[model samples]
Target: MMGRTIFIDPGRCIGCQACVSACRECDSHRGKSMIHLDYPDEGRSVASLPTVCMHCEDPVAPCAEVCPADAILVTPDGVVQQADTTRCIGCANCVNACPFGVPKIDLQAKLQMKCNLCYDRTAYGLAPMCATVCPTGALFYGTVEELRAERPGVQVADSFTFGTTTVSTGVAMVVPADKVQWPVPGGLPVVEINGKDVR
Candidate 1:
């Protein structure tokens, strides 16, 4: 069965950390927040990048491949799950192998922690806690058809390249419809500000 997926638009994030707080309230996580809210650039704090587990589809999953105990598994519906603590030996292999840096080993619990897309809730046709409490519409949970209709000008891409390997992710990103031209000039005009021209 195809399940509802989560989508993120970093531009819409205000760094309020409501998603992070909500993630902690997930019953499956045991008071741990799986989501990581970060500033992509320390100097440029205009936007926040919320890091999530991008359940890779193609190339299978790197975390699953490197697991010696078969701890990490991707569900049929494409949710890359947190490690099975019973089988997991706290080897930290999954922490190093994931391209998106999604998994982290809990030193105290000796287990891995990461986002499972709120499987406990999504399995019941309910949205994840993070998506449900987002103050700004930055985080969302919906069908692909609904996303396409909601964001007509953005392309949803799930694939990315890390080193020589191409990883396919289940979560899609909203990219501009037109190919991006980088190194574009800043939006500041050349004018005398305090007797100095701002470049």
Candidate 2:
């Protein structure tokens, strides 16, 4: 899976929760789903976005950097893995440091968990479970060229600017063909839906 990566298209998501369910089936985090469905406007609308680890690249993964116990690990392919249960101190440093807000601290288990892109399967040349079950193609796994050929009207983006800090990631986001970066106002993370940007 050298060049393959997960592509998220929020506009196409149907909020079916298929990805979340499938994620839990992975061997790494059995019985617990690392993927989260975020409803930007909970009461008003059903518009939901699937949130997964971006696997930060520019600063080399803030989650891994702030891990005092060195529980977090990054693969050579740039997939930021979930924390090591044996080493994790349950300090929530990675959870707070992640700009995408993907990590979850299991208080009872006292462990940090997040998506590893299903490394157990991906390493064997298989698509991630979440991407495999996504009905709306909101979460897809493939190379950039494959995505471009499959959906020519959209473009892929991997870099995002949060406040003044710009971060690149292993996963790519499928955005409108005309734009690459959607500026975040006041440093708050924003998500694009129906061609409009929203927080």
Candidate 3:
């Protein structure tokens, strides 16, 4: 199954809430609003980047492991998905479980919420609304394999931040061969170096 991940560059994000508005407008979501505009900082009102469910590929996903209600599941493509609210008791165990803090609670439905990566839109052969609406060409959408093939030598700041990530986050980001800041943690890691997978 194609994971249908949404990729965004924080440095590149223009802080447009188009993705947020589109998710609500699409209206496939039955229980809760799927996406939200997020801010990395609170003091100065900086360019808050858009963040949603990461859909991690790890076998021991934090959300699924911690959910008392088993509200979250990992798809083959590594997308984290929320379970049906009918089975959900609104305990918020999953909400606390995410290290990245992606899940949101729907005050009206009294259920937890996160993005499904616009399964409906992709099904109809359209780009994710936010990626489409990005005026700065910051946010990107594609397969992990595809991204790796395109960019190399970039490093993840978070992987280094947390002891060692088991390829913890699989989504690959591109930094120009002559760029300033790396995407995730620091610089982009080369998925393949010299036409060979880095060991």
Candidate 1 lDDT tens digits, 84-168? 9798888899899787788888877789888998999988889888889988767878876777787665555566655445566
Q: What are the Cα lDDT values of the candidates? A: 0.76, 0.86, 0.58
Two-way TM-score contest, 2 vs 3, winner: 2
TM-score of 3: 0.68
* Top TM-score model: 2
What order do you get sorting by lDDT, best first? 2, 1, 3
**Model 3 C-alpha lDDT per residue in residues 1-199, reported as the tens digit of each score:** 2444455567777676766666665545743446666675656667766665656555346767877776666666555666567766677777776656677776567677766666567556676666666676455676645445654554222121222343245333334455424324421344556558875
Candidate 2 lDDT tens digits, 23-107: 9999999999999998978888888989888888888999999999999988888888999989998999999989888999988
- Listed per candidate, the RMSD to the true structure in angstroms reads 7.4, 4.1, 9.2
In candidate 2, list every pair of residues with a backbone clash.
none
Regions of model 3 farther than 4 Å from truth: 1-4, 30-33, 41-45, 123-125, 144-167, 170-199
TM-score of every model?
Answer: 0.84, 0.89, 0.68
Q: Which wins on lDDT, candidate 1 or candidate 2?
A: 2
**Ten contiguous residues with the weakest lDDT in model 3:** 155-164
The better-scoring model by lDDT among 1 and 3 is: 1
- The residue-level lDDT of candidate 2 at 176 comes to 72
